[model samples]
Target: MIERPIGRDVVARQRFARLFSLGDRRAPLSWSPGLVLGPDDPELPVSVAPLRSTRSYDSIPATITICPRDNLCYPFDSEDKWVAQEGLVLPPSLVASDSGMFGSGLEAVPVSWNSLHHDDSLAVLDSEPSVIILIDAPQLAQRPGMLAEALLTVRTRFPSSLIWAPGISGPDNCALLTWMGVDLFDLARLRHASSLGVLLTGSGPRKVEETVNEDFGMEAQCTTWVQAISSTRAAIREGTLRELV
Candidate 1:
């Protein structure tokens, strides 16, 4: 059972900012800006364990972290210390999928919108997962019509599940994706930008090499994103979220 409460009452034309309470002790995840934190163990509110991995820690309500077949972070191992210290326990969801695309042990059945026939695609939606990850997001990004169609299909079939699009975040598209009802995003692009020595300003990514050394770092980039998300959330609340896009 997904215990998380989505504040649909505040939704302005399918847009909303809500809180996801994991447990009584842990801080409830605030979606005043949607959850776009780092993809690290400490950053997540729910305890995540791969479905195929040995249980190193006691079972907690796990949000199956899905990854593509080629993703290096496959076979995610749970840290017993984090679970014990943080008390990040969650109820297990009934939804399950068999797609081998997940690198994490989480039972996320992958649904490739472009690869599967319409009937097969509809079958995947029957599980009604709390989160639906778009495995072929890059392809969807290239084809707006396909992305819209996929988002629409999922919204129609599973109105409640949060849509996640990995490897698709930056100053360029985060607000736009959130406007489209994407509830989750990976921090890969942020890390990539940091590695390239680029600073993410409101205008866009600027090469650090071209600017003064004092203003560039991962911390600065993360701060910028946090502000952007906060601003976007404010817009959503005011029903002006589309203006940011």
Candidate 2:
């Protein structure tokens, strides 16, 4: 097998959309892009938004970071309505609308295949997206080998595509994902854990003590956790994310 590239950073083009594949080999890929507002464009009234854990990721403004998910049809359907209402065009797709309807704004929805034998989505993404990120969810854990097979199948189908995975956090997890060539990841699970009173330190998870503090609530906790994730991203840029995790 050919070795995947390492220590590569992707630069997004002005009109490029970065796609992320979620779930197993049998599951289809789901992707979204990070949208940024142009300087000359009219700026909308900025909302002092509530926390994402409270208001949901879709309601939040497009920032330097992005978080996409696998089982997103449900959320996307509802979120797209707001997108239309807000008159915003998400990244990867050059669309402008008074209303945001998920999938409706895009020329096509991102799809996933069980393997190379079934990959029809690869062609569509290749025809577009300046860069594509492939992630191996299964490879992140030692619990299953089937995940690796599925990722391999996807890789074989899109060899020219730029992908990266496993993500930063765990040793075996990062190794497996990097080995498979997943370049980007969303760290929502860690945030979710923080919201649930779990603390992730250098040694891994430990429950937050009840006596830690009374003033910190869900939103505060999420903020704290997100800041840590931000630091992790910085580390990732420095090529030390895997080591920190």
Candidate 3:
């Protein structure tokens, strides 16, 4: 197998809509912006046994694993302050990222739109990273319009690297964000809502009522995710996602 570097490649495009594959070529993760992870989506999981954990994940097909604090100077935990996770066997597509405000706690450097107005942004701008994780996505979503503007700004700034806004989206705003250009999202929000007895839908979150025979099991949650992601992907391809907005 050829050893491809950690990177993202655009396989298809429709205006700002993007269809890209990223991570190691061995098990590349592919998607278009506004793609949200459900319970069973392949993921970039961060954990205490960053190295050994990834080794175990190899048996699973097509998962993207990224080690936290891959940098020798930054450790996963204070208890393991001297340990470095760089030896973790993962898809090369995971991360060989630059340091910024987060000092390398994750596979991709953590940054926020707030940095643009401050001096700290210089470090991020200077690194010219190929990928970045948006740390304040939830906060951006809370405000009326900051999220879209920030998304546009980052797209302009990087122009090439993929952008990940983890734990901040689901059926709720996937189309809106996809329209704005977010390259990645995760199921953290969906999983959390399920645990809280809430069922999420494209329209909004609804309280799951046991009296109504509504299933709140993991399988059910995964099904919801599959439907949402599938429809959004199809919309992107059909050029009707904007119509849904």
RMSD in order of candidates: 10.8, 15.2, 11.2
Backbone clashes under 3 angstroms, per model: 5, 15, 2
What lDDT is obtained when candidate 1 is compared to the true structure?
A: 0.47
Candidate 3 local Cα displacement, residue 165, angstroms = 1.8
Error of 2 at 51 (Å): 15
Name the runs in model 1 displaced over 4 angstroms: 1-28, 36-109, 115-127, 209-214
- TM-score, cand. 1: 0.60
TM-score of each: 0.60, 0.38, 0.63
* Predicted candidate 1 versus true structure: per-residue lDDT over 1-245, tens digit per residue: 21222222223443533222221223321342344343341233222111111123244323333321111121222211111111221111211333322222112333445323323444553345444566566667776487767666666775655566656766567678776666666556777777787777556787765445545566676666667766665676677767788
Model 1: colliding residue pairs: 50-105, 51-105, 51-106, 61-90, 61-91
Per residue, candidate 2 scores C-alpha lDDT tens digits across 1-245 of 21111111232211111223222223423221111112221221111110011112365332111122122232222111111111122322221322232211121112212212233334465333222322223333333554455456545555434343322333123322434444333334444455677655434556766786633244444344334434443444455544543
> Which pairs clash in the backbone of model 3?
23-93, 24-93
Best by TM-score: 3
**Candidate 3, superposed: residue stretches over 4 Å from native:** 1-5, 23-29, 34-107, 119-130, 209-212
**What TM-score quantifies how close candidate 2 is to the native fold?**
0.38
What lDDT does candidate 3 reach at residue 219?
A: 53
Ranking the candidates on TM-score from highest down gives 3, 1, 2
Q: Which stretches of candidate 2 lie over 4 Å from their true place?
A: 1-117, 121-126, 130-143, 148-197, 200-203, 214-217
As for lDDT, the candidate ahead, 1 or 3, is 3
